[model samples]
Target: MPMSSKTMNMLEGLVKDSSFKWLLGKQSSFDEEIEEMGRSPSAGTNWIPELSPVANVVVRRCSKILGVSANDLRDSFKQEASESLKQPSLFARNFLEYCCFRALSLSVGVTGHLADKKFRRLTFDMMVVWEVPAVASQALLSVEEDATVSLEAFSRIAPAVPIIADVIICENLFGMLTSSTGGRLQFSVYDKYLCGLERAIKKMRTQSESSLLSGVRPKKEKILEIDGTVTTQPVLEHVGMSTWPGRLILTDHSLYFEALKVVSYDKPKRYDLSEDLKQIVKPELTGPWGTRLFDKAVSYKSISLTSGDGVPGA
Candidate 1:
């Protein structure tokens, strides 16, 4: 049955409620606001907007028109529901899109239903599948017609692609997975400087090879600590503690440090941004020796780099 004029007017008020309006205006896009609900910088962003706190009249009337228990919608399911309800079948996707659009357009008197002719026609022609793009193989995404894949199961096998899955399945049809390896391999702005430092080091090593032929004992070789191709110049160089005062080299891919002295034997400590470099924070400048703080040192310019995740000093 179609909603009465009084009922439609109440629905309009619910959408315009101060709390809901605040949420809608907080972000430039619905996807940004919804996705960052739990993880946004502000502690208050974690607070989910509840339908119950609204005027009781609005809640009762909107709930009755929507044909769902108001109590179910009132709970703090902002994170869980936004995540789980993300990857529903095409039928469910269409149903949700219609509902959201209908609710937003209530002032204009638009109405919809899951059993509508247009929705039913789309559902009939659809193939309910999880199209994951990481493996680039047909087996990765294709879902069998009778197969039922839960959100929990999908979370385990492809934990990295949850955000993408949420966006696509909620909107409709399919989603693509970005290459995690490629994301790591991407270089930063300081790459060119790192590459120059690397070339200079190589040239110095070649010149020193002549000394090895002479009677003079050759210096111990410094080991390469990181794997994968790094193409960048060293924009920042410092001495930091990795068991000793190690030579710290900051480049596009990693923060690398190693002791040049006999104690460490040129074995370097490497912290690759690809592995777990979440955030860099709380930098401090300090001294080379105990209680003797320097404004500038030969290494690091007296600046100490600190990582939020407790990566060794660099």
Candidate 2:
């Protein structure tokens, strides 16, 4: 269902009142599109580190910069990360995909919202093929609605484009103070009824052709299997962290949002969190049931309509 025009207009007004003019200055395409949408534009751009293949080069460089043996670097990275996030090669590759995507999208003037749209489109395409249910944990299984389908529903359908979001939150005070911080990351799989950064990846992937991501939630469940028989495995992990390099994986959106706010606005405490610089945020995945539900709610809202541009989601 399309959001009422009035609601959208109101949102646009909010963006205008507290304008990020700097973001606008950096994103001409973004600005024009918003204008086209009959909305106002912010100036400042939300600058996130680009996830690119070159990052593989960068990680290698980081390894060199840290002055550690190559083998040691890989081992330490894995040792510090969640067992759920142990695939160094895949994590590097996906990070690179994220890098390449922003670079490519930047070339086309699709910064935040536009790029976010691309992510969703790609996620949807993956769902059609993978046949992964739109739900993740038992909480997502529809209760009021029940249905019986045949084995044809179990036909060996193709897999989703091995896409997953491992949302992590950095800035664990205790870890930073004690020089022990790492991501307690959560991974979520997106399908039709399910939605998330996958929506953004789905769109971006269509335009870029990179596999986005897929998978689950807490109690340290690293193994995911449908029907409790066959299963897929966790492959990615935080690759490296030390005293100065700390990490925290977050599955919670509100906390993630708060972290983003604190990092961006609370400058006095920036150094306090700097110990968290080596962090990876699976924000889309990190948090309580409420946070996870918010993520699901976003997906639920996203499925109700087809957006041509922008984060244009519900």
Candidate 3:
């Protein structure tokens, strides 16, 4: 189902609010408001107090989008939260995350919304708020003021692409986030990654359609990760005493290695990943001329192959 503009607008406004006290329907005096601001900068930032009244408006809408009742959704969140020790504030924050994650997961599936700037920004803000979701009244005043998201939050929103189309993986998303933002996820870096992922998915779809039209075997598996450098970080594939530098691509069903032939790449060799093969993939030592001098490669071995192939760390 298409997400309503009103729903998106409401979410956009909700996340943009630095404080959620307004949603509590509480009217405070001028002095109380000033005092609240004078408290720890991180205090009351993570959760909204007295959230039950607003559930009809906020959580209910999200539950509707998910095709679940509001009470059922709340119960499910509580059940999940109960798996770990649950505090009042933590429970509330987790509930909010549950709603936001489910709703965003649905909304992104709508056409042209996955790469929308507002959607990206809203998701990033949700992540930021999720990182510190709890009223920390005694939080240190000297805490860094930098606004950044964390790996935990990134994992929640990043996997949507892979789950939807398998265009990327969690590791690839983390790599992009860390490479650009230096381990701290900023909105700009997050948005750039999403845009790139969208483009890659589109390109892959076009390629699949073209292959089908040309009477070629359509790509049946989704690309999981591609790692290689034409000139710099060469990916080495080792067989016997010989090694060839190439680009490695992993898919849902197999691995493909395209050897670098001077200024171009040779035809890719496919290695199937199947249950019947009894494949064993593990980290092993590899180096020049069959010497096991460096422990920086992954070894792929199966009963069907005489010699296992090793791929350098990606």
Candidate 4:
């Protein structure tokens, strides 16, 4: 179901609040305090009230947005008592992550909402919170403060792009994130990627309507990855004793390799990845004349293709 207008207004108000902004910026943790509550004599004591003032407000707001009781949301943070006692700080941090992840997942379903400045900033703040969920004695600093996120955090909140183009695999996502932000994803870089991905999908859709490959690509096929740059890194296809430099493209259903000619690319040869061909893909070495001198290639063998034929290694 779509989020109600009232809920959107509530979220906007929450984000605009000075205290909430301070909470996100500071990332204060009350883990030690919460842990002390766990040791109270009263059994089943409500621990939500013991959270830091801003955190308490955030949790209550999230509960309201999720249409659940505040206690219900608190109970969702399940951990063995022994474990929580041993690593209370870690447990507290993880609980914060859980709440933010659930809330953001619901709010970011619409791509158009991502264009909203408040929504964008809120999403980035969530990423910042994930990095350091609690107050620390010693601060952890990056090139950009509260601006970088790990791959795991990015995957949790990133809007699904398969609706636009192809299913994003972890390997491809990692490559894009690392290439742009040098292993830690920055908000600006991430936002740019989302905008570029939307434009690329639209452009590809228009091109596919009249392109020669329209007859070749199967119905519902979405391009996953394409590498053909000669200036940076050229893709090379190894077949038996001959090595052919080419452009390689992977889709949901198949792999296409178009060998590079003098100035133009040869007709793309399809390698079916979705077929029941008992395909095997693994890392292998490649060099000149079938010499395995460099461990920088992947070998692909299927019932249809000869064992000597290998996919592009770049």
The clash count of every prediction, one per candidate, is 10, 65, 0, 1
Worst 10 residues of 3 by lDDT: 208-217
lDDT of 1 by residue, 184-293 (tens): 11122113323444455455444321211222222232322321112232112233432244344444454455444443224444454433434443354444333225
lDDT of 1 at 188: 23
lDDT of 2 by residue, 129-177 (tens): 1222211221221111111212222121111122322112112321222
Off by over 4 Å in 2: 1-110, 113-119, 131-164, 167-314
lDDT of each: 0.31, 0.27, 0.56, 0.56
Please provide TM-scores, in order, for all candidate models, with all chains considered together: 0.20, 0.16, 0.47, 0.45
Put the candidates in lDDT order, highest first.
Answer: 3, 4, 1, 2
Number of the predicted model whose lDDT against the real structure is largest: 3
Cα lDDT of model 3 by residue, 1-314, tens digit: 33345434433443334244345543222213223332424323212333422222344446556887655676677677665535664665667667877887788778777567756655665565555544352131111224577777677655554432233465565766677567887766667767886787665555321222223223577665666744477788888767888777777787777777877777776666855788878888887787887687788777766544434332
* Model 4 per-residue lDDT tens digits across residues 1-314: 23345434433343344344355664223322223223433212222433332343345445555777545765665642345533666654566656665776676575565455555555555555555544341143111333577776566545332332233564477566679457987767766766676666555554322243556887799886666645246677777667778777778798777777786667778788898999877788887777778787677778887645544443
Clashes of 1: 10
At residue 159, candidate 4 shows an lDDT of: 39
Q: In model 3, where do residues sit more than 4 Å from their true spots?
A: 1-47, 50-87, 137-146, 160-172, 209-220, 223-250, 255-270, 273-314
Ranking by TM-score: 3, 4, 1, 2
Model 4: runs farther than 4 Å from truth? 1-121, 124-212, 231-233, 307-314
